[model samples]
Target: MPTLESFFAPQDNIALENEAAEQEAHLIAEVEETFMKLIEIREAKFMDMMDAREKKYRALLN
Candidate 1:
């Protein structure tokens, strides 16, 4: 005895939407964290390069 109303469960839509929103938020947080890590890596690399360059200049002066 399947009625037309049984084909669609409207009550489940809210839960589904909430779950999707939670997943999206989690993904966004992960992306932000990854981006911060990349920035930190880039900054550290730049600092290392600058230090190396400064040492080279100091060696040339002496």
Candidate 2:
């Protein structure tokens, strides 16, 4: 039982678009943070392995 004017209001579209944009921004931020943390963990593991290999090689040399 709603009128056409109420259904097709201009402000409604703007509000919906703004809400979608905010949600997208929030999701992007979360994904970026997760990726950074993953990268840091990978780097730390790689460094640890490299150190272990170097120590083993030095022990063999000596």
Candidate 3:
């Protein structure tokens, strides 16, 4: 014999909210990692270009 309160229990979205939060956290982590990789690649490219320029200048000087 169920009570009227049980029949009219509130339907909360706690579970859905938690699931969405978890997904958002995962996406943020992935985006951060990708951004770090992009920064590393940019640095590497800049270093390579500087090295090439230095070699050209040294050749011109000699």
Query: Which of the two, 2 or 3, has more TM-score?
Result: 2
| lDDT tens per residue, model 3, 1-62 | 98655554354355566788999999999999999999999999999999999999999999
Cα lDDT tens digits, model 1, 1-62, are: 99865676887777777899999999999999999999999999999999999999999999
Q: lDDT of model 1 at residue 54?
A: 100
Task: Please provide TM-scores, in order, for all candidate models, with all chains considered together.
Answer: 0.84, 0.86, 0.80
Candidate achieving higher lDDT, 2 or 3: 2
Task: List the candidate 2 regions with Cα displacement exceeding 4 Å.
Answer: 1-8
TM-score of 3: 0.80
* Index of the highest-lDDT prediction: 2
lDDT preference between candidates 1 and 2, better one: 2
| Candidate 1: C-alpha lDDT | 0.92
lDDT of each: 0.92, 0.94, 0.87
| lDDT (10s digit) by residue, model 2, range 1-62 | 88855776789878888999999999999999999999999999999999999999999999
Candidate 1 versus truth, CA RMSD in Å, comes to 3.9
